[model samples]
Target: MIFRHTRLIMGTALLAVALPAVPAMAQDADEARIKKLEAEVRALQRKVFPGGDGRYFEPQIDSSAPVTTTSSSPASTTAVTDILARLDALEASLQRLTGQVEVNSNAVRDLESRLAALESGAAPAVAADNLLPDEQPLPAAAGPAPTPPPAPAASGPSAQRLAAVQAIAKPQTDDPGDDEYSYGFRLWNAGFYPEAQQQLAMFVEKYPRHPRATYGRNLLGRAYLDDGKPREAAPWFLKNYQEDRNAERAPDSLLYLAESMIALGDTNRACIALAEFGETYPAIAAGRLSNQYEANRKKVTCN
Candidate 1:
């Protein structure tokens, strides 16, 4: 994804995947952004190749001969200082473009991988969480009543508690991924919500591509939800879905997002999230998540 000057080819595939399922107006807006970015790129190219020929790999600092300025103009207007400033500007622009390309490229590759993973399955694109064995879903009636966001607890975890978690000296199990997740799950299940949140956050960060990572992210949101911080919880679920709907926990994240929305008294947005979940995971809505999905729909009063 890093666009080294030596390999600066922009592929059409990067341009091909507009944000999936975007409305026509949003699609147009995305295109406009791309066009603006393209225009900026072309402007940079022209500066790098003044002759419009791709002869130079980088902006020429001092080609062969040294440059000396002998001008009556102000010091700020001296050719060398101005040229140096322009070069600095060019380097900054290149860095910006490089970062943008890297992000877009990674997203495209992620989408492609998800497509391949879900090819045999009924759903379209989904997350690595899908590869793991399904966890028992919460009963519809078990959904929590709406609650306000909570203030932080008085203090951080006790030193002894941190030491115990750190002292968990299990050997690297064959399924370390499961081992990692189970530790956090155990913490959460035991009502160590803050500690569980911390450990789950760590698990997701350290093993982002692991099958359990996606679930860890959803669980992070759930931890917030269960802790009576729906304001804090909504974002995690919404973002997990927005980023990669193929994620095994993405449907769960969406469901939780709606739940968070309801808790926050945003029933209109809650209905919208429910609608999106139904639209994005129709088969899931009819199957594994059917009960929870239906419960959310009825709660939101969506048609």
Candidate 2:
């Protein structure tokens, strides 16, 4: 199903792209290509709305196959763009449905654990859901009175370590924002997830126009993920990917988005992200991001 959405979008995008640059070709070849696209669209509709009336929806590709199209035909291109937008909406709906499924699955698991505990005469499963990766702990102040006290504050060298790393690194470039971002990077690299998140978040918010802002945003997501909080991480990665698909760190954001989704038990969405990364950034996927993407794809076992 995910692949179907990807193929439909990419295929239609290809049409919008190929239409403008099509070489002078035999009329029949253009017709054949349009025919293939039309067929794929129909197949997609049937798969998407199985056992439903086919007449309710149809691909809007004109059969004439204007071979000399330029970028000027905004009216004609709008329909194709709209089709792609609707496909994206459908994909979003599917992801929401998957999230609901995950919630339901977790509920069932909690119930099963409770029943097992009863059978064995063990402690109640009150905190079974806490064991779930996607379950976020309440804020310390918001937690129940019975909740365990927050961990003792860092002390001695630990306090020194935290305060010491909070200072920004020396400026490597003219941009002080770059140094601020490096501070977050150093924190993350040193395994200070919470501090890294705070630092990166401030850096991103304060210097939204900085060259390293994209890097800052992506690193913020990494901090959350490293802190075992994928729910916190996924949105930042997604925002970076959606906001600036061509940014230097955008590919990393997309890949990390997949990893976070997988961690959160939403392999359906993770698979979609993985497929998008492969489709939209094939070169990067085959180059620097290849290993991580491959490992993540294996985690989801994407079809």
TM-score of each: 0.46, 0.48
Candidate 2 clashes: the total is 0
lDDT of 2 by residue, 71-139 (tens): 434845897799999999999999999999999999788655533322231111226645667444332
Off by over 4 Å in 1: 1-177
Residue range 76-163, candidate 1, lDDT tens digits: 3686698999999999999999999999999788655533332222112235676447422222211232122333588656798778
Best-matching candidate per lDDT: 2
What is the model-wide C-alpha lDDT for candidate 1? 0.66
User: What clash pairs does model 1 have?
Assistant: 125-246, 126-246, 126-247, 127-246, 127-247
Residue 26 of model 1 has an lDDT of 74
Candidate 1, residue 150: how far the Cα is off, in Å? 14
